[model samples]
Target: MKIVNVVKPAIRILPMISKDEFPRMSIEDVQNNYFWGELINNQEGMYNFRKIGMNAPKDSLVLFQFDNIIIASAELLDIEKFVIPKDGKYYGAYRFDINSVKIFEPITLAEINKIDSNITAFSQVKQEINSLFMVEIQDLIKSKQMPILPDELPRQYYGKRTEGAKRQIVVNAYERNYKARQACIEHYGCRCVVCGFDFAKFYGPEFEGKIHVHHVKPLSEINESYEVDPINDLRPVCPNCHLALHSKIDGKVYDIDELKSKIKRLINN
Candidate 1:
C-alpha cells in the first residue's frame, strides 16, 4: 500500500461531520459557496513548512463525501502556516481549505470505484490520494448534460412591459438573494459560467464578491411556494454574460448556453 505523493491534479475523498450527525445543511452551505474557515491539526492540512520549506501545492481536487456518497466537490485554494487563535491550531498549522463547484449531480461511490478500486482503497485522511480524481472528473464532465435552463420561464421579460399596460406588475427581483445567491456562487463556482472568467483571480482580493448572480428564470414565475433550487435554477455569471443573458432574439431571450456559443463564435471569428 503506497500513499501517493502530494502533487497537482491530485484527488482526495474526505468525510465531514455535523454536530447533529447530519451534514446535509453544512454540505448545502459549502456546495452553494466557498468554505475554508476551520483548521484541524494532524489531518491532511498540517504544519509542514519546517519539513518541506513551504506549504504543499495549492491546487488539487477535493471531494466531500457522506455515507459513501460524494455530495460535493471543491478546489484547493492555498495553504499557510500561521498562529491564529481563531483557527483551531496555530504556529505551523494547516488544513486543506477550498472554494468549490457543486457537481451538476451527486455521484455514488460504487460508480467511482467502477472507475478504479484503488481510489476507494485509500487509507489516509481526506485530501488527495492520487491522480485518480482526474479520471472521475473527466467522466463527470462528459456526463454534465445540463448547462440548460428550466422549461417554464415567464413570457414577460424583466423590466419590459407596455407603457399603458394598466396594472404594472412589479416583480420582486433579487439581484442577489443571500442564501440563493451564495448557493449559485458555489454551484457555478465564483467564476462566470459563460466565459469562465473569475474576478478574484483577475482583479485581486477587492473583487472577491464582484461577480453577479443571475436567476435562470423570471422572478415572477417563481411562485410563492416555489423554493429556489440553486443547482438548476440559478447561475453565477459575470456582468457581460448577465447582460448577454437577457439579449433578445426573435422574441426570445438568449439562454446561457446560447450566449456562451455566441461568445465563443465571436472569439473564434
Candidate 2:
C-alpha cells in the first residue's frame, strides 16, 4: 500500500471554572462534578447536556454536559494541570487545560439515554466512559452566561487517515511492532522524531498535510513475513525527513538515525 498522509479532527470544550467554586479540586474531582448546561450553535440550534466524566488508564478526556448537549470537553494529554490564576477576570475562577472547543448540533434525550445505557453496560465491564455530564439549563441561564456555542468551542484535528485505514494501520503495527511507535511518540512528546517541531500551529489539517507515520525498518527488510507491529516500526515524521530517511541505494535502506543526525547538524549549522 502506498504511504498516505492522514489527519483526524476531534472536538473538545474547555470550561473556565471559577476558582472559588473549585478552589482545591483535582481533575478527578472536577470530572465527577455533575455540571451541565446548553451549548448553542448558530447553525445547529441548541444541543442539550448529558453526562460528564473522564477516560481512564489515562484520565485524558474530561467532559461536561447540558442535557444531551456536550457544552464543554477537553483532552487531558496536552493539558498542563495547574491551579486557577489569582486574577478574577474570568467567569469560573478555576481553569482546566484545553486545546480548543466546538459546539455540535443539539443531542436528544433519547440519544443521551442510549449513551447512558451504553456507558452503564461498558462500566460493568470496566470500560471507559466518553459521554457528557448533564447540567440544568436553569442554572446556566441563572449564571447569566450565554449558552456555550459550537463556534466558540475549540477544534482538534483527529488525523487525515480514514477510520478504516487508521484501524488497519494501528492493528497492523501493534501486531508486528508491539507498541514501539507509541512509546517513541510519547518519549518524543509526539513531535516529529527527526525535525523536533512541537508548535501547535503545525497541528490540524495543515500539520497533517505535511506529516506521516513511517516504518523505520521497512517491512521488506524484515526477515519474517509476519504482520507489522505499530509500536516497533511506526514513527511520526515530517515529509522531508521521511523522504531523506527512505532514500536508498542498491536496495539497502538508508540509515535513519544517520539521516536524522545530519539533518540536526544542518539545522544547527
Candidate 3:
C-alpha cells in the first residue's frame, strides 16, 4: 500500500522522561497522564523538550519515547515557553489535541532504528524522525485498533452532568484507562465474564472485537493515579452486565461475583 506523504511534515522523537539529571515525572506517570486530560490541551508541560526551545514547528508529528519505548504519537499543535515558578525556570511546552493522540503497544527503540537507521538513540533533546521511518510510523498508527471508552451505563444514567463533566468522572473518578482496557481484553477473551454474552455471537462478525472492559477495583474509591494490573484490575463485560456492575443497589455498586449472583438468581427464578 502507498504510505509516503507527498509533502511530509517534520517528525520528531521526544523523550517523555529526562535522563539529564533533572527531576521530572516518572515514566509510569507520564504514560498514565498521556491519555488522561492532565497532559492534553494547552497545559504547561516539558513534553517536547526539557530546555527552552522548539525544533519542530506546528503540525509536525511527534513520537513520545519513555524508557526507550515509543508509547504514543500526536501532531504538534504549538510550542511555547511554560514557566515553572517553583523551579524558577521556563521550558518548552508542546500543546496537542487529546483526540489527535494515538496510543499503541510500546515499540522499542531498536525496532524504530531498524526502520530508520538515522535514529541511533533517544535523547532528552529531540531527535529527527526520518522520512522512511515516518512512513512506517504512519502505517503503524493507522493500522492499530485503538478502542474507545464505551458507556457501561447509558448516558441517561449520568443525568444533569455536562459532556465534559461526564468525561472527567470517567477518567478521574472511575479511573478507567482505555489502555488498561486493551490489556484486559487481550488477556481475557471478549466474552462477558459475568453473563457470558458474546457480541460477535449476538450481533454478528462485524462486531467481533466489540466489548466493554470493566475495571474490577472499586471505581468510585479511586481518587489518585496508580498503575493498573489489567488481569487483576479489569474484566471483559458486555454492555448489559457492564451496566449492572455500575448500578447502585440500595447504596452500593455490586462487584463481579455479586452481579453474577444476581444474574443467577433471575435465571433460577
Candidate 4:
C-alpha cells in the first residue's frame, strides 16, 4: 500500500546498537529515551563517525533498525558534530523530534527485501531513498499496528553482506551535487587548479564554466557520511588533471601541489 506522493523528504536507515551485541541497553530502552528526547541529552546518539549522510537533513525521516528489524521511525530535528574527551575523537550525534517517534512492529530485512531488493545490505541502504520508495516505506510503517517484543528476540538474528553498490552511490552523490560543485567553482574559479587549464580560453565562450570539480578528500577514506565544505573539499580540474589526480603512486593519490609540481617539472624539462 502506497500513500499519497506527499512528504518527499530524504529518508535514511540508521543502525542502532543491539542488546545482544552490547548487553547494556535494549532497543526498548533506546526507544523510550528517544520518545522522551533524552537520547541526545544523554549522548547516546553519539557515534565514532557520522552515521546519516548530508542528504538527510532536518525533517528527514529516519528508520531506526536494530539487528535486521526496522523497529522505530522518527523525524530528524537536528545533527551536530561533537568531540569526545575520553577518546579524543570526533563523533556525530543526531536529535530527532520525540513527538514524531513511532515505535512500530518489527519489519525484518527479509520483509523489506520483498518490497525492494535493492536494499541488499544495511550498509548499502544508507541515505539512498527516493520519493516513491519513501512513500512506500511510510505506508509500511503506518500499516503496522504494534511494536515488537524487545525482550523475546533471539541473539544473532540476521546475517550481513557488503556490496560495492554503496561506493558507486556515494561517488555519484559526491560528484553530482550541484550546489557543492557550484560553490567550489565560485571560490576557485573555472581554471584547473593543477595545470591552470581554462576551458573558456581553449574552447571559447560556449565552453565557459565547464570544469570538473574534484573532491579533495577521496570518498574511499570517508568512513561515514558527513557535511562537506565546498571551498575546502572541492577543486576545479580539467579532465586530464582529474585523471592524473586519481592516479595512485605507491598507494597515494597526488594532491594538487604534488600534481602541479610534477607538471611544472615535466614542462621545464
Candidate 5:
C-alpha cells in the first residue's frame, strides 16, 4: 500500500481588539513589520504592503490574513490624521476604504521563485508585445477613431521599418520656424500681424495649414553679423500676407521691427 502525504493549509491571522488599530504608518515600519503583496498579478504590477494601524482614524478598518490564518487587525478612530512615512520605500499612506483593501494568503519562498521564472520568460518576448500595440493603433486610425496627421505619430514610430510608409520630411527646420512664430504670435496675438487674418481655425481642409514664419530680411540677405539674433530677425506672417510683404519691385529688404510697425499701422487704419 502506498501512503499519500496531505498538507493542512495554514489558518489566516486576524486582529483581536478593535481599539488597537492605527490609521497609517511610515513605509519603513510597514516593510519591517507587515506582510507585503503585489498590487497586480503580473511582473508589471505595483507592489503594496499591509499592516495594523497604530492610530487609525474613525470609520476605518484594518484587516490581515496569512494562508488560512487570521492575523492581527484593528479599527481606526480618526482616519484623517493617518500619515504614512515618506522615505520612498512604500506607496504613501492610503485611506481606509473597504473596497481598496484586499487580503490574500501568503506565498512560500518556493512559490515566489516559480513566479520569478515566469517573469523572466515574459521579458524575453517584449518585442511581440510592442508589435501588438502598434497593430492596435493602426486599426484605430483605419476605423477613423483617431485623427491621422503628417506629424502626429510618435517620432520613434514614424520612420522605422515597421512603420507602413512615410510621405512628409520630418526636419528640424520646423523647430526654427516654431521659435520665430511663437515670438510673433505672443507679441501680436494669433491674428496675422500683416493681413489681420485669424489662424485659430487653420486646421483641416478649410485652411492651407496655419500661418508661416518668415525671416524678415530673407535669411540669404542677412549679413553674417546678425546670424544669431533670433528675436531681431524673425517675424510671423500668414501665407498670403508673407507673399505681399515681399511684393516690392526694388528688392529692398525690410527689418522685422519695421514690418511689425507697418502691420500695426494697417490694422489701426
Candidate 6:
C-alpha cells in the first residue's frame, strides 16, 4: 500500500552511518550516550561545503542505514555551516540537525530478498544509498500494526557527517557559543588577521559585516568549561583565511601568527 503523506520526503534514505562510528564505544554504548541531541558534521557534503544541509529537508523522514539495513528513522531539523579544526577532505563543512529518532529492527538482505527479487543482492541495494521506495520504508520501519519486534524507545537523535559520511554527536561548547560575537567584532574590527583583507574595502559596504569570526583557542582545549574574553579569544577573518587558520595540514596547527608570516613570505617572493 502506498502510504501517502501530505509532505513526501524531499529525499528518502541516506546511508549516513556504518560500523565505523564512535570508535571507542559499542553501538549500544553510543546509543545511550551520544545518539540523541548529537551533531553530525562533514566538509565534503558539497564542493561549496555550506550546502550540505540541503540534502535533507525539514520535517521530512530520513532513514539512517547501516550494513545495508535500516537502523533508525530521523526527522530532519536544522542545517548550518560548521567549522572544525582538522586536516582532511572534510575540514570545515555543514551538518544536518536531526531529532525524534526511532530505531527499527535490523532489516537484512535475506529479509529484503524475501520481499523482492530485483533487489536480491545486499551490495546492489545498499549501493543505491538513498534509493528507498515508499513500500521499502513501510517494511523496514514496521512490519504491521505491531512495532518492529522489541520496540526501542525513540530518542532525540542528532547527526553530523563528514568525510565519507559518519554520524557524530553534538557536544556543547556552551561558553564559546554564548559569548557576545558582535562585541568581539566591534573591538577587533572586521578584517582578516592574517592578510588584513577587509570586505568593506574590497566588496563595498554591502559586505561590511561579512567576515567570519575565528576562535583563537580551540573549543576542544577549553577543558569542559570556559570564561571567554571575546576580544582576546576571537579574531575576525576572511572566509579563506578562517579556513586556513583551522587547517591542520600535516597534523599541525597552522596558527594565526604562522599564517601571517607565510603571507609576508609570499609578498616578499
- The most accurate candidate by TM-score is 3
Residue 95 of model 3, lDDT score: 76
- Candidate 1 colliding pairs, count: 2
lDDT of 2 by residue, 43-155 (tens): 11122211232223222343344323344443333322224422433212112222222223433334444534544321112133332433332223234333321111111
Candidate 4: tens digits of C-alpha lDDT, residues 1-269 = 88776545677787755643336765554544343224433443333333333446668888877766788787877777665433444355566664456666787777676677777667534545554577788888888735222111111111121111122210122212445656778999999998888999998996888787777766556645555677877788888888778778899878889999998999999
How many steric overlaps does candidate 2 have? 54
Q: Give TM per candidate.
A: 0.41, 0.28, 0.51, 0.42, 0.26, 0.41
Question: Per-residue lDDT for 1-269 in model 5, tens only?
Answer: 99998532111123322223223543222311232222111211222323332332243334332322223222222222225643433333333332232322332324322423322221111111122233332233234222212212222211112222322222111112233345555665555655566666556544533555555555334322222233555455666666656556368644445666876898799
lDDT for 230 in candidate 3 is: 74
Candidate 1 segments exceeding 4 Å error: 1-7, 20-30, 33-56, 84-100, 121-124, 127-129, 132-136, 141-175, 178-269
lDDT of each: 0.52, 0.37, 0.64, 0.61, 0.35, 0.50
**Per-residue error (Å), model 5, residue 109:** 61
- Tell me the deviation in Å of residue 236 in model 1: 20
If both were scored by lDDT, which would come out higher, candidate 4 or candidate 6? 4
Q: Of the candidates numbered 1 and 3, which has the greater lDDT value?
A: 3
Q: How much is 146 displaced in model 4, in angstroms?
A: 1.8
Q: Which digits, one per residue and each the tens of the lDDT, describe model 1 over residues 1-269? A: 99998556556565544433354554434433223112211133332322222233566666666555666555555655555433442344334442233344556656677776656643224644447458756567447422322221112222222111212111222222355555666777888888998898999985786676676775545533355677787787887787677656788888888888988899999
From the highest TM-score down, the ranking of the candidates is 3, 4, 6, 1, 2, 5
Give stretches of model 3 more than 4 Å off. 1-8, 18-29, 41-49, 82-87, 149-269
* Model 5 spans > 4 angstroms off: 1-177, 201-209, 223-230, 250-269
Best by lDDT: 3
- Decreasing lDDT order of the candidates: 3, 4, 1, 6, 2, 5
